[model samples]
Target: MYEVVLVDDDVIVTQFLKRYIPWEEHGFKVVASFQDSHSALEYLLENTYDVLVTDIGMPKLNGIELIEQLKKSKSNSYHIILSCHDEFRYAQQAFKLEVFDYILKETMEETNIIALLGRLKEKLDQEQFTRNQHLKVTKFLERNNMTLKSKFIEKLMKEQNITKDGWWKEQEELLKLNFSDKYFTPILCFIDRYQEAINHYENETSLQFSINNLLEEIFTAKDQQDVQIFFTQGKFLILLPMKYNTREKTKHQIEAILKELHETIYAGFEVSITSVIGELNVKEQSLLESMRILLKNKEQRFYYKYNSIQNFYPISYTRDSIFQDYVEISQTIKELILKDKKDQILECISQQLKQIREKKYSPDSIKDWAIKLIIDIKLSLHALNHFERQSVVITIADQVIQYVETFEHLEYVLADICEKFLEQIRSTNLTTRNEDILKAQKFVQTHIGAKISLKDVAAHLHLNSSYFSRMYKKETGEGFVEYVTKTKMTKAIELLEHSTKSIEQIAFELGFENKSYFSKTFKKYFGMTPGDYKYKTKEKMN
Candidate 1:
């Protein structure tokens, strides 16, 4: 809808126009009205309106003077004049000032005014459509230009050699770059905490667009042809030309710009950036080399503190592999899981991730280690009969490595995996303990003829001794050692009653060391030694 403002000395006329114009039906809105032209001009100066309707004969300032002032300031409002027959000359002056139309107050009618507004709405609508089309075309061209530049830069980076004379000149002209023989410094940027940043946006494309807009605005503000920026392959490349004669001075210039860029991006968007600033005096022919060097050093971002801009340094990697202690680490994790040490499990994962970060291993090597570790953990669960293999979990384990862009992110992924694994272990451990207890009872009965130990029972169950001890005591109302002792005593009684085995022989068969210890234990449970019980039973039978 087009906004309309009215200015007329006649209060009645202004009120009537505002109240009964049916402006919405005609695609117009009367936003403000003033009985004096001066007040209307003041409002117009601060706000934008599409149409102005004012009376020519007013007090402090007339409609003609108001239009004249607005014209001087290049306001784009369409002006309509309100005049009586005595003010015909004023209307003439309004036409000279390029007003849209004139209305005589003596002959003005509601229908005529509404019809006029309809035409004005048509004109405004057409102009707005044209402006929108032009804007679309401009954006399309800009996007195409940026795409071409990005492709050209990518091609240069891929080719083994980049010559100054061959395809360089053609691309320079075609892409409208001025780096023929100029000295430039290259800078590369990686979005830190990219996973978090991506989640903050609607999608990846929106995030890219926002960053591009911010970069363009900042670089374009410098208004220098020497500065160029490109977004390609999940990174930003900035080419800063050597404007100063000395490298030190150029360095200072680059520093100032980077400081601004980093601070603004982080402050405005809550997004941290890691930048690698290159040499200040790289020639056009060495541009790709400088860029490649910067790109290679981008791996340094894996260890970079968030929101930092650092000068170029040689890339380094630790010679030792993270998998050297895989056996020890994996075993420790399994023990902790069975022990139900949740905090220790997470801390253990954190420690390994910290080591990997400190070593600054190649990204691929780190990811490989992470994948192997997680998969081995799942396999350990399966071996313990605590986990059933799920294709979904395996798929996650395989694809998770690709998303490990930083040490922090990698740690988060590994930590989440550990937590979920702990959940599975906890849930399954409850049911597993019931089955394990039953199996343990059966094993003890089968092995009751010999001496049974808690350690032996735990080993049979493939569980840690201390963990098994606690679980056995909790599941049953007796300690494992106590249970073993009771089982032996009960068997001794059965032998005494059912068979004519000698006391010494029965003691020996029940895994007792001798008759004295057997008798002592038997007296404690039945209030008599084995000989007394046997004699009493025989007396009762006779």
Candidate 2:
């Protein structure tokens, strides 16, 4: 029920109203009655009353003055004024203070007061319902607009040409987007460790909404005229208008803006972002090309650490040699799988990844290679009668492709697949007695990028270190340390021979502390330093 407060300087008037009015029946309760306006103002300050009734002419703190004070405090109380005279000044002041109604005390009766209160209650109810409906409609439109905008951006990114310019214009107008400028610069902001953000929020939509709101606030502060579109995979595209005279100057300005954006996001959400700025392109036709280049540049993010800002450069396609490398790696992995050498298969995959990284292959190329390798492995297993049909394998392969984001995640997935494949092979009467040793070997190979110790591997296998070490040497004809060192050195050699990575980078990639130690270890193993080996390999290739 709506609350009502009655205030009048005369005690008789307040008492008569309180005793005679059927407030509850009219959907209101006279919560408080006061003899003076001072006490009523104090009560109003402490509480909220929806309807206020008071005498217009009082000694101090009159109805006008009380409402003026309440208005200063931003009160939303509907007010009714009672006066003994039909004074124009009093009615004008009451209307100015937005009083609900003015009643002359000489003609006011119980029926007239009750009718006024009933009409006020109906007005209040109608206003509240209208407000709630308006809020829901606003929220729905916001969600629908975002979805439509994202779709339009996705289409613009994919299609080479926008065939219906008028439709595009209509869409922009409908969405209230300002993209009429001739030149636009596309920027891709990628949230680093996106999966961690997803896990933190436990909802992808919530995370994306938060990021979008933050971006909008930052852009609005900077007075940037841009359109932000979000991808489902934690990437945001911002198409900013080209406003500066020179491209370099525009780039610098965008970098400054992005730096502020990065700092704000990190400070607020504790999430780091990497932004790649693409070259400027014309609005309608060249937009798709610029988007392609922007996405291609986004792949270079793997080359740098997180929380970086980089500019896009056109990528020169030289895929013949890369395709050849992929073929060779595919054949090697197939052979390793056929032999049921899980450790070697993982090592081969790791080396192939290193090669791809060193060659600066695009992210799509790397993903393609990974998908093809999984497909080849699945087909090989089917051919060997390990699986009766391809449906299950195909489903698993699709899941792996969908879920694998980082190289570490892919490594684990592929290792699990190899383990399952090995189990299937063993089901065909080919079982090894030294399964524990094999487990240790696989662990060491898969974790070759990390600093793995004998204790770590032994604990992984749930075996004693001393016994596992002896068993490993007996089975592999090499001690635990020797095998790990051999595996790392073999990978190092492959990198030095086939990749363009520097010796220092190779050393770090192989978990060596320094290049000097890596060089000494390489000389001891290959009878030459890594530099000499790399030079010799290059010379032989030439």
Candidate 3:
């Protein structure tokens, strides 16, 4: 139904006109009534009305004059003029202003004016309904555009040398506004324990509703003129202009407010907060730097913090995942052992476990750089083993899973394993069953840097040199000398790549008298000099 505004200086005339119309039956509502034209004009400046009815002969601005003046004000209202004369000239002037109807008070009855209004009211309702439809479509388009803004940001941020003022120049009409500010701000918010949150909510409909409803509330409460929020790469970005208070622009306090808002309102998941403030820089350079600080610092957070969890990328996750993958793969190995699938069971004994070989890693190593080969294998094994096997060997998979949850835990687990195994191997005697092979492996692993030959190894094993060489080749396909060099080179590369020791330092560590000879052997095994190999490998890494 159309909204109606009634204007007349006489209070009785206004009230009589108002009561005479059956507004609901006429498909309109009397939404406003004014005793003076000034109040009606004031209302017109701030509001939209479909129909304006006023008395033509008034003390101040008359109906015909008001209608003519309102045209200059960009008012779209249809006018109905009330007059007291039977003047044809007045009718011509009213018609000149495109007044929908003119009612002469000297001759018109209340029913006659009501009937005229009823016809116009129906047309007004139709126009209002159509106008409402356009508004709905426009709002939908605006929302859709906002959803894509995050994608635009993702691509924009990938550019190397972009500046704050660049996007405005690059495509001025794309956003339909000239940016007057010097720079833009980037904020990254992520759902922490996201997997856990998904698990906590069973159904997709409920989970989606919960996330969307909470985000909706936040956005709806704030002025959305310069704000945007969306998900990318399994995380959310609440990117908007960082508003500085005119009185005192305290960046730290604003950051704290964001943290507190997340904690109070969005308590379902933890958030990580990463923000770059100021128009001094609009590029991701500041975001990149801030992310470095975020990764270096550890903060304890709760559920609501998910919307605030921020980093330059999914890096913290990558570091934490290494240890988690190790534990998961360990669990798979234990499962295969329990199932007694001995054919590929040993093959599954965490073969990729070799990836961590002798490397001293802090909690931050291998972030966002671990190969898909590792992650895919881990995911495949996890999916399969979610309900796969019943283990018999008192599965330490669960224990190891918790321990290997991050690089920090990986180190602890490794040191713990080495410590426990060293004591166990020392106390537990090797049976005569393959005692020779165990002793030989121990010797090869231990004596790689020595100049000992097959004869020396055979003598140490208490076997004749010719017989020992054949047995060693039979037990391991490799001949005696190759085995020693290969083992030595393997350890040498690990030390070179992962440790801080230099080539000369590694020579002493490996018991090699000649560093040059050690270098030669390393080059032979890896197809490059140690220095060149490390350079090429590290360069290729990222």
Give the TM-score of each candidate.
0.76, 0.52, 0.40
**How well does candidate 2 match the true structure, expressed as C-alpha RMSD?**
12.8
TM-score, candidate number 3: 0.40
Global lDDT of each candidate: 0.77, 0.74, 0.56
In candidate 2, what are the lDDT values of residues 1-542, reduced to their tens digit?
99999989988889889999898998999889887888888999889889889987888788889889888885577989888969798899989988899999897789999999889999989988998999879767766776787787777767666765787878878878765555777788888777878899888777776777787777777676465565646788877776646777887878887898899999989988888887665575566577767764555555545788878766553464455554347546755765678889878877777776677766566666667667756654553322433233444665565555455556666677767766665555312535665556556555556787899888887788888888777766678888788877866865675566789988887888999988999899989989988888879978
Candidate 1 residue 287 Cα shift, in angstroms, is 2.6
Rank ordering of all candidates by lDDT, starting from the highest: 1, 2, 3
Which 10 consecutive residues of model 1 have the lowest summed lDDT? 383-392
Candidate 3 residues lying further than 4 Å off, grouped into runs, are: 9-16, 31-49, 68-74, 86-89, 92-97, 150-184, 190-542
Query: What tens-digit string does per-residue lDDT give for candidate 3 at 22-111?
Result: 776777788899988878878876888888888888767777777887888755678888888668999999999888888887756767
Per-residue lDDT for 1-542 in model 1, tens only? 78899999899999999888899888888899998777788889888899999888787787888889989885577999888855557666877988888988887899989889888888888989999999889877777777878888888878867677768888888878887677889998888767668889967656766787787788778785567777775678989876557867777788888889889888878887878888777776677788877776666677666677788888678777566656456657756765668889889988987877777778788887788778766754553322464333444876876766677778788778877876765555436677787567656655556777888888989999999989988877678777777767766765675565799988887788888998998998889999999998779867
Show model 2 residue runs off by greater than 4 Å: 1-62, 66-92, 101-125, 177-182, 193-210, 225-233, 265-272, 281-284, 296-304, 314-356, 359-542
In each prediction, how many residue pairs overlap at the backbone (N, C-alpha, C within less than 3 A)? 0, 0, 13
**lDDT accuracy of residue 22 in candidate 1:** 96
Candidates ranked, most accurate by TM-score first = 1, 2, 3
Worst lDDT run of 10 residues, candidate 2, spans 383-392
